[model samples]
Target: MVARTTDTPVGRVKPCRLIGLEQHHDERGSLSIVESEWTTGFPIRRIYYLHNTRTGTARGAHAHRALEQLFVAAHGSFTVKVDDGHRQRAYRLDDPGTGLYVGPMVWRDITDFSDDSVCLVLASEHYDETDYYRDYAAFLEDVRRQP
Candidate 1:
């Protein structure tokens, strides 16, 4: 779980933290599974993956208004830096059995991709352009307006 560093709250959204998925290892190899009940308690509506990212490149410089997402490093590793307009934290994802759960209204910037990195993302909502806050200032404004 992510340790709270600020007394100032960010509405009902929980802070981003590392979630360990169910893993089984055998002579055949290993397998990881993420059940609905074992995740952020939201039904996954979209799933995607990022691969072949150029060197020194980054992605996800935005925040969702209502979308919750889980990110797992299916191969290699990368860094996910999240900001809640109050506190900021960086988590390194290097294990396939572990994931990072990002709640709504939190800004995310994913970077530091390895050569063979593959980032798998499971989202709670389908594609919606309007649901995203691509501007940091706008995201912070909306977060401040929350009651």
Candidate 2:
């Protein structure tokens, strides 16, 4: 895995990928499955998909405290903005075979849809409202004070 620079508030971005998952296609359609230990370093505990998004609409305007996520544009195209409280990075995702692994402590927002965009998220944990930092100002201070 390699880290790439993003337009996020954080100055650096770490890229990672898990193995043992494949996209299967046939005349019927397509299917994908994530198995345990598939990701080399990050372990997934939950999986979710977002669909039926309208063009120019945006979603996800919060940051996670402990959960890590891999965001994939399953259908169509969309842009994701990642903020690490110091720097922010933007990613354009349109490929079904690729994904952007976002670590904890980063604020993320998905937008700029191409009319048929669908986002699939692989999470390291289940939903927890307390684990999220929705306020940008607070997030920035938290990252700044982190040792």
Candidate 3:
């Protein structure tokens, strides 16, 4: 999600938001479509999925400096916690037709995976270790310095 940077007195737009995909259902099954040109604000450069995650285990304890991603629950359920230096929020993902969009500079922590869970990820960029902010304190400090 691309957040609005302007101050609103009430609250600033969050850097992470939920996006719903169009789903078609019938006796045959269900189908959901995601088009990069119309859905994701950024072009899709990579696609991946996480599965067989041990119960009680967690993932994603870092923030990206330039990458943007969308996460979907392709099988079961999990929790995604996001922080933007000043604010924090948690989202539960169980529906395959919905995805959580995480923008740059936002910290993400994924946890509480169910036994059959499969997490799908769509990224705007290729794998780059230099783009990752693995330390939370450093991520916070850097984001706070931004205008």
Q: Once model 1 is optimally superposed onto the true structure by TM-score, how far is the C-alpha of residue 136 displaced, in angstroms? A: 0.7
Candidates ranked, most accurate by TM-score first: 1, 3, 2
lDDT per residue (tens digit) for residues 1-147 in model 1: 232344444325876767889899999999999986456578988999999998899999999998999999999999988888877777889999999989999999999999999999999999999999999999899887877
Q: Roughly what TM-score does model 3 have, to 2 decimal places?
A: 0.90
Worst 10-residue lDDT window for candidate 1 reads: 1-10
Candidate 2 regions off by >4 Å? 1-33
Better structure of 2 and 3 per TM-score: 3
TM-score of each: 0.90, 0.78, 0.90
In every candidate, how many clashes are there? 0, 11, 0
Q: Each candidate: what lDDT?
A: 0.86, 0.73, 0.83
Error of 1 at 13 (Å): 1.5
TM-score of 1: 0.90
Top candidate on lDDT is: 1
